[model samples]
Target: MPGGGAGARRRGRPRKDEPALTERVVLDAGVRLLARDGLDAVTMRGLAAELGVRAASLYRYVRNKDELLDALADEQFAGIDLTRYVQDDWRAALTAMATALRRHLLARRDAARLIAGRFTTGPHSLRNIEALLTVLRGAGLSDHDAAFAAYTCVTSLFGFVAAEQNRLSAEVAAGMAPREYLDRLAGRLRAMPADRYPNVVALAGELTAPDLAARFDFAMARLLAGIDALVAAGEPR
Candidate 1:
């Protein structure tokens, strides 16, 4: 438990000449690189530079770009404690897992895109997916539905975070507020005739709250609710 999470890998500072071979060290270093630079910036050469190891040594932990992406995904998802959900009531458990997964993915900013679908092939990723599937299967989902539900939940999270990241800008990062940004946007929307775009005019205020977390939660809840309804209707998992 001590050597876990982001700080876990760095429980003690690395000695000047020592580099850690532990998977946690390797994954954390990679994540730090991706967070600082975008996904494209995380080449073997770049990762080696961060870990202070020869590029080839990375193979012990990850094989290629695909493997590297998997590792990244595993690191992000490592926070999930599946055992808690395993004992929860079926539908409630799945929804809870969805919310937790979305929050974890969104917290990492652009990191979600790096891991969404690569889990099946990566060791750590496969383990994470298996954990989720195990929980779902116990709750009464067929393997097929469990897999599909997993896909839907993951994609929903990725899309939500990606959209939120796109809307962020350097100026906004510094001091520009969303309210100021939306005020200007509202002015532009006002210039259009209400009669021409009745729904847009009436719901002008609704579009302004681009609350990434709230919107993601609302959408995820609805999607899971639909999934539950479908299941009850005898729809395939």
Candidate 2:
């Protein structure tokens, strides 16, 4: 009767206050270590210590460090709404995807760096790509052009987010203020002899001008817009 359906007993529910066990804990601990100290600190042992469990216990949930890292990478994409996102107007859809990606990466600034360059073919990433492909096709792009456009936009988003995250570090934040840094650079350029460098000295402010956020937005948006236009006007078959 112990293992039989006739008189088998169901497993008891855990007490309300009882701590449940799962890969969630493992992954959450990995994320915390990753966010606090970057990817290098996220060994299985380190994650176990962070979770207050034996290092060997992690094997029950994750097979190895690679699996944990994959889980951590997948966590970043957990915030995206693929169904809603892939359903919008092509340009609007692309913008939404980029914005969502930026927000997700910005939240766990360290996590962004870890997962950016790894072979990113997880379900979420593929779904996003498939959506991008579909949108490009809808906008009258050839297969090659669609793929290239998707690569451009996705990579640009990742690069922008990574650069922003790097600069947003506490050290950079506490060090030279961006505006002051730009002002100092402006001064340096102004000090240059106009006779030697007329063009640079004449446009000192233009050279050192720092409209970082707006400038970044303008650049990313323009790049995507350009790709959209080009893909929409794909070469003849």
Candidate 3:
């Protein structure tokens, strides 16, 4: 009789011995799905299946797909290390922070797209912004200028990563190596009439270089230089 009761219990609805699903668990599953299959595949139904739960169960943790994505972005932001970038020299600190952000974004597929247009007030995101503001203010920027600096840095990061990802995807789709693609582009640029586009023709090699790192570094330097000039002029603060 005791054996029969144990068997009945097993045959009956399985006990929920596993821990209850939390927002973290749902977001983790969503991130894995996003990384493996891209953003289109990271749906509530898909995530539920990944977690061996029903789609409706996900609603208990997140209201909808948008919220789920926000949770995912928050998780990604939580991983960024701003400690090394929070130093006396704001220029160095900002550079480090931007570099770190770009590196982290590129680590996951479609990650740049995920966080690009969305505004997140999550703790981690807020913390990162606070760190940036602190660094800029320390460098003699007023509150308004510091906020603007932080915004500029983040917008540049998102745009750069988004463009980089798109270019990589295009290269893969076209089945062309990065250098080969750039060479082809250079050739096209050189074909333009030298009289009409002399500068473009002359700078084709530099313009079409495949060195993304150099391009990013140059852009960052220019941005910081503009800020330094403004600071020197005692414009805002």
**Steric clash count of candidate 1:** 1
Which candidate leads the pack in lDDT? 3
Give the lDDT of residue 60 in candidate 2.
Answer: 54
Cα lDDT for residue 44, model 3? 76
Tens-place lDDT per residue, model 3, 18-101, is 346765676778889988988889887898788887666555567667777877776778788676589998899989999998
TM-score of each: 0.73, 0.71, 0.82
Per-candidate Cα lDDT values, in order, are 0.67, 0.69, 0.78
Query: Predicted candidate 2: what Cα RMSD to the true structure?
Result: 8.0
Give the poorly placed runs of model 1, Cα more than 4 Å off.
1-25, 52-61, 121-124, 169-175, 193-198, 235-237
Best by TM-score: 3
**Model 1 lDDT tens row, 158-237:** 67776666545565667788678777666767667888987777777777766666787689679878667756665553
Q: List candidate 2 stretches off by more than 4 Å.
A: 1-21, 168-178, 185-210
Range of the 10 consecutive residues with the lowest summed lDDT in candidate 2:
1-10
Error of 3 at 39 (Å): 2.3
Estimate the Cα RMSD of every predicted model relative to the unseen true structure.
6.8, 8.0, 8.6
Model 2, position 47: C-alpha lDDT score = 81
